[model samples]
Target: MSSSESQDETHLTPSALGTKAHWDSLYALELTNHSSNPSDIGTVWFSDSDCESRIYQYLTSDDLSLSPTTTFLDVGTGNGHLLFSLLEDGDFEGDGMVGVDYSEGSVELAKNIAEQTPNAEGVKFIRLDIIKSSTELDFFGSRIAEEGGFDVILDKGTFDAISLSDEMLDDGSGRRIYEVYPEKVAKWLKPEGGIMLITSCNWTEDELVKKMTSSNSGLEKMGRVKYPEFTFGGKKGSTVCTVAFRRKA
Candidate 1:
């Protein structure tokens, strides 16, 4: 963890937006340059479990609504690599795909990558911070709610990064992201939607399930657990955890 900046916990909640410097510094470095295999972002992270789980969700599930006519959003998208990977692997089409990030550099890098692939043309990267500019959710949620909802919403680490700052979660900024973001995500989902969250923090699948489950709810009615839809155990035994959540029917 790099200790360079301090956060105003009260004002900058996970829902709150990030600052300019906050994102610029993050995008200053080229992500592909650091990874051993720039092509394989997941492997370069040196993790396997979470990446595999996420891949399964995209490849096997309708989470991204890739019905040759689906449309969706990628919050806190870095270089738009995840969406890029989807275009390559899923071979699925959509009305469009939009990626938003606080870092202008990252947004542009994603755009540059999109140019290399034809299917990814609709994939536009927006240089906006989610913490500051999630208001669109209100307009979008209603739209999805009325229009059969989005098939999927995928988030790999937007919430995780928010956890790294000062006290809010670490202290009194409030609760764990695993606890909070899920609800916000639920609100964004299109009723029968799905959310695939990949994380590298200390929380386990069971813990995350419980957190997402109706809080204060009992054991007999534990949130239904979905067995790992996809598993990838690479050279690394245990790495990150990818928990997939389906909007309850």
Candidate 2:
């Protein structure tokens, strides 16, 4: 693995992790590591097995159905393993799948991984700062709209990253990026039945559901995937959660 993307962990402040430079540096190191060992894929959010199992189980469940023409969008797609898993193992024969991230290095690494994987043919990776408001940064948003929007949008850790970033609010009075995320995503998803699936470590299921149902978001909570339970100080909790929402018809 790349030295930066190694198993060794390090602590970072929210301010530091929120910058494009931070993620760029991380992926730059991972790209170098991937060059040496192309088989070693990096997982920035969580374990590959955990992500794959949960997403696959959700897609195949009666709650959601997929067809050959369904389209997918993956926000903040780190190493692109989620899409890889869906294509290679989940029988996802969708019309197309696109993965976007703010870090150019992250998108580059994703492209590299996609290029090397046979099942990832036609997968697209784009560099985009989705945290920025469309009024100031509308390129990615326009591109997504012009492409007819997506049937499913997957967010593994993008929202959590925004929630942890110090730059979430430029001014103390302005709305945070995390606060605008649901509405922004609503614009890129096909209405009526479009679905957005999120996996997070920083928020509980109820909190995410509340965010989705906020005024002007036009999203309704479908449900969430349960994780392994752990008890700490007599309280039950899980370190991670996956929640789903559908755009209003």
Candidate 3:
């Protein structure tokens, strides 16, 4: 592909939401809000689309058969709500759930919420940048390290936020960080039967699948979560989409 076509294929205009500073500030404010009112856990991204409920259903459905013992990792786990919901509502064990984010404020906010949430004592919140240090899965602790990798990995809005960034990798590839995200994170999924589900509003279903299943990503599309469709200019699409992928053996 030509340079212009390559740029068009990979680029998304940078936005404030794409920066660490933005999340740090927002989570700090959210932390304050939680201190004042424990019920205020913070924003639930894509809640209008019922994203969390659909994801829970997909995981618990007969097709996946993910049990309570199944290990989970939530990328960019803001407020740790998704894991908490899975634990509380879906009866997934808290001990097998872990949430990671780069922002300290996000980690702190999640930890605080976990303390207040029932049966959440086992859920862990860690501060780590996946794109920069995704290779360091050992830091995720003994169970995950010994088990090889998590059974289910989730990315809700994290990839979309990453795609909005203009930051380039330091490897001299001249590619944005988001371009390398799939490969970076895919390694954390078990080579056998592990699944990663991602929800995005910025990209269509086809675009999300292409990014995850790119030549270097070592992942393949397994399934998708259906959403209400709308027709605009004779084209049918949804405001948001969720797709599942499994690491290629």
Candidate 4:
């Protein structure tokens, strides 16, 4: 669980990414709401109705599926809503899940919620920024490697957080996201692990694959197979999410 975003950059905005202020404001509002409710941040734009239902479909399927004892990472875990959604799911059967976020308030709320929630076993929430190439990524990777690389890593809105403005993205961050992210995920993931990324960019599944082909040497170098995209709610067309999955290489 890692989040990467700085607060000072006001000029640059990738459409789907969250600024530090955005998160700060979100937590400021959520502070009054408390984290004990079934769903703390119910109306977050990131978890739009379409995306919300779509995420459940992903979780029930092989995207985040795990045994009774598999470790998981939920990136950009805002208010622990997505993670809580999984916890509330009647069909979930995983072990040792953790969420990471940048907002201190959100992180504290999430930690409190996970600690107090019923049936939320083996779940922990931490506060850390994944942007700026911080050690949080290394910290997660090392922690996983020390025990076991996460069997599954799920990114609900993180990359969308990275789907940035042309100028801010031009700072080598977007390309680095495309380059280092996949490899980094693989490094701390099991050989038979899974990575699921859900995004709302205009890029379709094939367009994303093509972009990744050029940006990520590790993805190209490793002979990993791409699973076909899964349509949510039996909808045929893309549903604001271009989810890509690959076995750890």
Candidate 5:
């Protein structure tokens, strides 16, 4: 559940990585572009859709066999690109696409983007702070349980953002967000083969699998998606990777 904790400025994004304000600021900039050309909603983290597209391929692959009605949830969904990508892919006629983020601006931006995309009518963009544990979360959790839980949950750098939070580095009590995320997310997913897919640049595939499985009691290592390779000083690895874990009964 520990990592080298990247201390390099190269990994630091211009906007603060792990805070509500950081995402708010990022969408504020992209909101301008979205207004000018509704189709130009900016992509953060990866410059291209390669990582996201690969994730869709993996889900639809023979292993997962994700269907149109699979009940998808995108945690910390920024601008809802991943959900939209899933919807737009050929042969994916899914419903109940949900995207939640802590930032109001981020949710608003996602809503705006969804409005422009024809197939995104069923998508739900909710402003919820998944990092917080409170009565409010309890209320939300009840509603999630009412819906019978999601079949698949996607985390595109959301856990990485949580890991980089100042609270995670602070005293032990402040570690609640990082510690509770996997548990809370697991609860929101339908058990007995429900999947949690995470795409991260901050953590390697091994680190991510360890973190999720260790923190969440019932998660089992399913598999991971391979991205383009990067070589630094002869050692070869990818700058980013997407990993999937399944919830067991």
Candidate 6:
């Protein structure tokens, strides 16, 4: 394949949503709005599709056999709503949940919201850029670090935003930042039975599976969160897709 073709296959066009400034500014405004109205929790990202509820159902399903003590990490946890919702709707315990974001404003907003949320005392929100802090993932906490990794890691639109960035890795490999994302985050999962569930609106189910199961990611398809399918011009697809992966044995 030609270099251009390879680039096109691996990268998505850059957009403002891919930048930290965009989220910082938006979350800053949300923090202000939330101060006056505790009910205002900012954007839920794909709420129209009921993405969060479906994700919750998928985790709570009997097939997974996940328990309330299962540990979780939410990457790019904007407003930390996914983690919050899981605690609110599922039998999952809050002590085992954590949310991390690169934007300080996002962390602040989530932390503030947690204070007002019932049974949210154990949910911790931290600010860390997963891409840049690939070598320092131990910042999560002693429990997580001592446990080797989390039981499950979730990415709701985080990879989509990362893919939209045009930034390339600084390692002189000529690879875009998104290209290395799978390998970087996959290390945070426990080697035994850890799982990662990613929901994306930008990539098709096949594309998402390919990206997550790339050779270097050490992950394989475990399952998926099903959504209603629609046929457009005889092509069946959904507005979004959620895929689950587990570390290769």
What does candidate 3 score in Cα RMSD to the true structure? 1.9
Off by over 4 Å in 1: 1-23, 31-54, 61-66, 138-149, 167-179, 214-237
68-179 in candidate 1: lDDT tens per residue? 5555667677777666666765555633566777677777667766666658876667676454344545444454546554555556666566544433335353544333
**Model 3: per-residue Cα lDDT over 58-162, one tens digit each:** 988999988778999999999899898888775588998999999999999999989988899999899889888846568888888998999999999999999
lDDT of 5 by residue, 1-249 (tens): 233232211222323676777778888888888888887887655646388878878888886776777777898888888888888765464356778888887898899988878688877888887767432323444545666677789999898888776554234443434656677777777766688888888878877777777654478778888787879999888888888888876
Question: Model 1 RMSD to the real structure?
Answer: 8.5
* TM-scores for every predicted model: 0.63, 0.84, 0.95, 0.67, 0.83, 0.95
Clashing pairs in 3: none
Backbone clashes in model 3: 0
In terms of lDDT, model 2 sits at 0.74
lDDT of each: 0.52, 0.74, 0.88, 0.54, 0.74, 0.89
Clashes of each: 6, 0, 0, 8, 1, 0
Model 1 poorest ten-residue lDDT run: 216-225
What is the alpha-carbon lDDT of model 3 when measured against the actual structure? 0.88
Clashing pairs in 6: none
TM-score of model number 4: 0.67
Question: Candidate 2 residues 79-116, lDDT tens each?
Answer: 98888878876467523788888888888899998888
**Model 2 quality (TM-score):** 0.84
Model 5 has a clash total of 1
After TM-score superposition, the amount by which residue 24's alpha carbon in candidate 4 deviates from its true location, in angstroms, is: 1.4
Deviation in Å, model 4, residue 210 alpha carbon: 3.5
| Candidate 5 wrongly placed segments (more than 4 Å) | 1-15, 133-147, 168-176, 231-234
| Model 4 stretches astray by more than 4 angstroms | 1-17, 35-65, 89-95, 134-138, 141-143, 165-180, 184-186, 211-213, 217-236
lDDT of 6 by residue, 72-119 (tens): 999999999999999986599999898999999999999999998888
User: Mind giving the per-residue lDDT tens digits that candidate 4 earns over 48-157?
Assistant: 33565556565566634555555677776776666666667655542467787777877766766666566775667777665544453346655576665565566665
